[model samples]
Target: MRSPHWKRRLRVVAEFVLLYGALLGADWLVTGGSGFVTLSPNPYGLPILVMALAYGTEAGLVAAMLSTAVWLSHGEQVAPTGDYLERLLGLSLTPLMWFVMATAIGEVTNIRTRSLRRLRRDRQAAAGDAARLDRAYQDLVDANRALQVRLAIDTASPGRVIALAAAAISAPIDQRRTALRDLLTAATRTDDFTCYRVEPDQTARVWLRGTAAGARPVVLPKAFVHQLDRAADPLSVTTAEDRPLLADIGVAAAALRGADGTIMGCLVIHRTGFATMGSHSSAELAEIATWLPQVLDLGAQPVAPAASRAGRG
Candidate 1:
C-alpha cells in the first residue's frame, strides 16, 4: 500500500473509479429522474481523503478532479431548467466545493508528516550523544586501573629496605615489627622513633620507644591524649602553649590514619634540630604517616629505633 509500485498505481485507479460509480448510482436513486434536490451524501470526498494519506497530495488532487466531474454530471440531471450560462454556473458549484475541500485536507496532511519526520531526527541525535559519553567514561576507568597496576609504594630511607620486605610478607611477627620500623625509617633521618596507640579508654599507650623500651606500655597523661586526638597534621612544637610532651621529646609528630581516615596511632621521629625541620621535613613525615596504621593492624608493634646513616638534613 505504501510503495511506489504497480500495485499502488492500481489501487489509486480502482478507488477513483469506484467512487465515481458509487456517486452516480446514488444520484440516480435519490433524484429518481424527476427531483431537483441533492439528498444523497457527498461520499466522494472520503476517497479523496484516503488517497491524500496513502499516496500524497498529487494522488489526492487526481482523485478530486475525477470525483468533481462525477459531481457536476449528477448536478446537471437534478438542477433547474434555466438560462444556459446560469444553469452551467449552478452545476459547477458542486465540483468547485469538493475540489477546494480535498486540496485543503492534502495540505494539512503534508504539514503533519513533516513534523513527525523532524521529531524522529531529533531523537536519533540525542541517542548518539549519550553513546559517545558512555564510551569516554569507560576509557577513563580503564586508564586509571592501568596506572595503579604499574605503581609501587616504598620508603625513601636505606635502613628500611629489610623492613619493607618483611611487611610485604604475611604471617610473621618479626615481619610486622620490621614493617612498623620501616614507617619511621621511611619518614627521614631518624635519631629515635616511637609509636603510640590511642586506646578506647581515652588513654594513650606508648607501645614502643627508642630501640628497646618494651616490657610495659607507657600510659600518657590526660592532657597529652586530649591534644593528640585533636591534631589534624604532623607537628614539631617547641612551644609550651601546645603539646609539651611532643616538645619535650624533641621529635616531629605525625598521625597514623586507617583506610577509612580514622586516626589510629601517632609516630614521633626524634630528629635533631626539630624546630627548624620545616616544609621538606613535614612532607616526608606526612608521606610515612599514611602507612603506619596498616603495619600496626598486621600485628606489627614498634620495637626499637635502629641506627641509620641517612639524615633528613
Candidate 2:
C-alpha cells in the first residue's frame, strides 16, 4: 500500500501536468500553432500561480519548473531572438516571474490556512474547559445542599434528632430505603455508598445502593463483613493492614444493630471527600446508623393483602 504522502505528491504532479498542458493547448490554438510560452501575456504563468494558491509553495514551485520545461520543449519558437546576453536574460525572465509569484502566493495561502486551524483548535479547547467548569459548578451546588442537611442534623438538639428519626420511620414501607439512602448521602456528604439487609442464613443482600458518576457499584467483601461483626464500633480504614480487608467494600462500615443488639444489617461507605471524612462526619454516620436499624426493621413487617374489588364487578 502507498503512503498518503506519496499519494498526495502524485496527485499534485498530475494536476500540474494536466492544467499546464491545457494552457499550452489553448495558447497554441490562439496563436495558430505559432507555439506556446511565446505569447506576450505568457499564459504558462497562470498554471504556476493557480497551483501555488491551491497547494502552497511546493506545488507552485513544481508548476513553475514544469512551465520552464515546456518553454525548452518548444525550441527556437519560444527561444529569444537576440544577442547572447539578451537571450540569457529573456530565457530567465518568465521562469523567474512564475517562481516568484508561486512562492509569494503559496506562502500567503499557507499562513492563512495555519491561522484558521489554530483558531479551530483554540475554540475546541475553550469548549472542553467550559463543559468541565459546568460539571464542577453542579457538584458545588449538590455539596452545598448536602451540607445544609448535615448542618441541620449537627446543630439539632436531642429532641430534634429524635423527631427526625420518627419522621423517617413513619414514612411508607416502600419509601423507607430511599429515605435512608438520601439521609446517609446528606450526612456523609458523598453519594457513593451501599446498604445491606442481612438474611437469616447470615448472608448480606443488597437492600439499597447509591453511587456517584464514574464510580463503580460497591460490593461488600466477606472479610469486611467478618470484621464489622466482630468490631463493636464502625470500622475506618486508616492503615495499609486494613486496606486489603476492605478492598472494594468501602472506606468505612457500621453494623446496624437491633434492640437486642444483634447485627441486623450493615451500611458501607465506599468513598467520601477528604474534607468531609473527619471525626465530625464519622460521629454523624455512627449516630445515624443507630436509628437506621429501627427504620430497617419496619421493612420486615408483612404487607396486608389487597382488598377484594369483586363487589364492584
Candidate 3:
C-alpha cells in the first residue's frame, strides 16, 4: 500500500523534470543563435509553480532555474550587453530570486509533513496505553472473583461435622475413639491440635492426639470437666493465668454437647505457635455442636459391656 504512494510521488517528480526540460529546450531554439531576449516574465513560471506544489521546493527550484536559463539565453539574442554590471545582475539575480522562493515553499511542505507524522505517533501511543490499562483492569476483576469463591466455600454449611457426630454415635464403644480421631483429623486439617473426649464422670482423658514436629501435647486437668459441664455454649480460653492449666496450650477451646443438654465431651482445638482460628472456624464449630445431639440420637444403639470397657480403655 505504501509503495504505491511513493511511486506516484516519483512519477510527479519525473513529470516536473520533463516539463522543465522541454520549456528550456523550446526557448533555446526560439533564440536563434545569440540566446538573449527582452526582460519580461518567463512563460514557464506557471510550470515552476505547479512543480513546486506537486513535488516540494527542490523540484520547484529546478523548474525556476530552467525557466531563468531559457529567458537569459533568449534575452541575450534580442539585445547584446557589454556592461559587466548589467550582465551580472541580469544573469545572477533572476535565478537567485527563483531559488529563494522555491526553498521557502519546500520548507512549508516539510513542516506540515512533520506535524502530521508526530500527531499520528501520539495517537498510536495513547491507544496502546489504553489497551494496557484495560488488560490490567480485567486481571484485577479475575482476582476479586477468585477471592469471593474462597469466601463462599469457607462460609458454606457445616454438614461434614454433623455427619461425623452421627458416625460417632452409631460406632461401637471400642470404635468411639476411632470416630473421635477422624473428627480431630478433619478439624486440624488447617492446624495441629489435640482432641480430648471429657466423659460424664468429670475425668479429662485424651481421646485423639495430633502434634507438629518439635511440639508436645499438654494434658488437660480434671478441673476442665467441671468447667465444661457448667458452660452453656462453646467457650474459648486464651489467657495464661485464668486457665493456667492450659497455659502451655496456645489458643482456643470448644465443647461438644448431647441431646438432653448434657456435656457429652469437649472438643479442645489448640493452636500452637502462629496458627489461630478465624471467625469462620469458630462459627463452624458452634454449628457442629448444635447438631451433635440430634446426630448422636439418630445413631444411638445398645453397646456390649465388654465393648464399652474396650472403648474406655
Candidate 4:
C-alpha cells in the first residue's frame, strides 16, 4: 500500500469512476433520464462506504464531496422556477448530514481494521519468540546432560580402556582396534567379544583381542552388511527393531571408522545399560563416542570437558 505511488493513484482514480457511475445511474432514475435528479436516497452513500473500507477516511471524504456537488447541480436543473429557493434551502442540510455520516463510518472502519492488523502482527511476533525459547531450552538440556557426563567421568575413572581410546584417536590405523578392544571389553561386560572387518566384496573377517589369523572365516549376513554399509553416521542401537544384525552379536553399538570416516567396523557394546559404569553411564558412553570419533578433526590437544557441576537452571 505504501510503495509504488502509481498504484495508489490508480486505486484512487478507480474509486472515483465507480462513485460517479453509480451517482449517474441514481440521477437517471430520479430524473426519468430526461430532466434532473432529486437528492433523495443518496447514491454516494454506498460508494463512500466502499472507499472507506478500501483506502480509509480520506477516500470516503473525497467521494462524499463529489456526490454533494452532483446533487447540488441536479437540484438546480430539476426544481421549478418560482419558490424553488425555499425547497432548495429546506433540503440543504441533507448533503452536510451525508458528509458527516460518511466521515464517521469511514473513521470507525479504518480504526477497527488497523486494530485487527496490529493484533495479527503481535501474535506472529509472540509465536516466533516462543519457537526461539523452545529451541534454547532443548540446547540447555543437552548441555546439562553433557556436563553431568563429564563430571562423573572426572570424579571416577571408567578404566584405562577409556584413556587408551582417547589416546588412540591420534594413533596409527592398526592400533585403533587394539585400544578399542580394551574399551569394548570393559564396556560390553563380555570376554568373547569379536571385532569385525567388513571387506569391499561384502565379506567380513573376525578378530579376537590377541589372535591374528582366524580359524573360522565368518561371512557376515548379507542383510547386516548392507545395513552397516548404508550407515554414514555413528549409530547406537538399543531397541530391537533398529538393526537386524544386532540380534546375533550386538545389542547396542557405536560404529567405528577409519581416519577418513570410512566404515571400518563397530565397537559392539552390550545392552542399553550393562557396563562397570557410573550413574549417568548412558550419557558418559555417548560423550565418549562423540568426542572420540574414528578420527578427530582438531588442530589442538583435546582438553577435559566440563569440570564445574551444572545446575537445573
Scored by lDDT, the top model is: 2
Per-model TM-score on C-alpha atoms: 0.41, 0.47, 0.43, 0.42
lDDT of 2 at 76: 65
RMSD of each: 14.5, 16.3, 11.6, 16.6
Quickly count the clashes in candidate 4. 0
Deviation in Å, model 4, residue 216 alpha carbon: 47
lDDT, model 4, position 237: 48
Give the alpha carbon lDDT tens digit for every residue of 1-313 in model 1.
2477888788778877776666567756775632223444456666777777766677778877877755665665646688988887877766676667667777778888788778888888988988998998899889877765533442444445445645544637656566555445544545366778767665666865655334323665656655655655566654334445675554567666555444456776655445436557766666566544544652244332222112122
- Considering summed lDDT, which 10 consecutive residues are worst modelled in model 2? 304-313
lDDT of 3: 0.57
Task: For each of the candidates, give the backbone clash count.
Answer: 1, 0, 11, 0
Shift of residue 185 alpha carbon in model 4, Å = 19
lDDT score, candidate 1: 0.60
Candidate 4, residue 4: the lDDT equals 90
lDDT of 4 by residue, 162-199 (tens): 66666666567677666555555454444444556556
The lDDT per prediction is 0.60, 0.69, 0.57, 0.57
lDDT of 1 at 232: 55
lDDT of 4 at 271: 35
